[model samples]
Target: MSTTADRTPTRHTAGVFDIRTIIGTLLGIYGIILTAMGLLGDPAYDRTGGVNANLIAGIALLVAGLVFLAWAKARPVVVDERELARGDDGNAVHEAR
Candidate 1:
């Protein structure tokens, strides 16, 4: 006799393993580093026509990273334990033959 809880699907979020999360984290880290360099380090205006490339790029990366993180937070990937357990076996083709 299965209870209501037992019949319900066991689901969980992809968490840190999600691609968006990984990308967001990496971008955010790099953004911070670049932004710091642009602010404190020497900004050679000669190479980029007086434009602070590091600062501009860092800000852009930060914004993109935030967007990705927000997207992942808003719509997380859910995984069902039942589905994972029911994954196809390698012998399926052999059996069908």
Candidate 2:
């Protein structure tokens, strides 16, 4: 008897709950807050360096956050189940209806 078993690994992918999503969400939130502060923050910071560094840095962070979010969306992580049920003939133990 020649049994050519399938080599597919058992994997249960977790959708929208990966590390990328977490980092993206957190960065996006911080970006929003900083951008808001940069726009509406007090004018005292401007006197320190004669420039609104907060506004500029905030905008940069906001862009970075958006990039991370987009990257996560573009490529999501996949997790698979570790259970594989095979029959004596290298076939699936259960048949699909």
Candidate 3:
């Protein structure tokens, strides 16, 4: 009675509020803002020994955020239908040959 569709593996959908995406996007946006401010060559930075702290920190944050996003994409959770099936004795049943 089972069709090929029934054998397909399913993945829990990434929630509307996936933490990785949220954090990465927020960090990327903040980094862009900070980097832009730094590139403007603000006088405030001159007071800090001419170090563009905002630019350096923003670039680092941007890299970190990108890495997080990439990690999320590279690995994902999957649950198979056969894995979910159980027998009357509460043991997993194998539908294999």
Candidate 4:
């Protein structure tokens, strides 16, 4: 006996990992670091010698990451029935009625 899956069609989809995704990931990481600095200790500035660049940078990264994440989530992912049934060689045949 054979599975109907063998008769079904298969489809392959390429992964999506573009510059935006990379940038978003990097920014998110930076945001975490900045947030940590903001919590741990004070930041240093060139003029005032007490600037919280870390906090600012962290916020920026967090925001950027969020935006990219949103975009990524918005993308749709689809799988055809044929693909799912490709390997199922079960009783799929119908008698002439």
Q: Best candidate, lDDT-wise?
A: 1
TM-scores, each model vs. reference: 0.88, 0.61, 0.64, 0.52
Ranking by TM-score: 1, 3, 2, 4
- For each candidate in the order shown, give its overall lDDT on alpha carbons: 0.83, 0.62, 0.65, 0.64
Q: Which residue pairs clash within candidate 2?
A: 11-80, 11-81, 12-79, 12-80, 12-81, 13-79
| Candidates arranged by lDDT, highest first | 1, 3, 4, 2
* Tens digits of per-residue lDDT for model 3, 1-95: 99977766543535324567788888889888888877875737557786888888788889988987875566533333455553234433222
**Highest TM-score: which candidate?**
1
lDDT of 2 at 53: 70
Q: What pairs collide in candidate 4?
A: 3-88, 3-89, 4-88, 4-89, 4-90, 5-86, 5-87, 5-88, 5-89, 45-51
Residue-level lDDT of model 2, residues 1-97, one tens digit each, is 5444445656543446766567767777877887787789874564857767767777777787788777766665544333333333443222212
Off by over 4 Å in 1: 89-97
TM-score of 1: 0.88
Flag the better candidate by lDDT, 3 or 4. 3
Candidate 1 lDDT tens digits, 1-55: 9999989978788889889899999999999998998999889899989999999
Q: Model 4: per-residue lDDT, tens digit, 29-97?
A: 889988998778666666446767778778888998979866655552334446456547554332222
**Model 4 misplaced regions, further than 4 Å:** 1-18, 45-51, 76-97
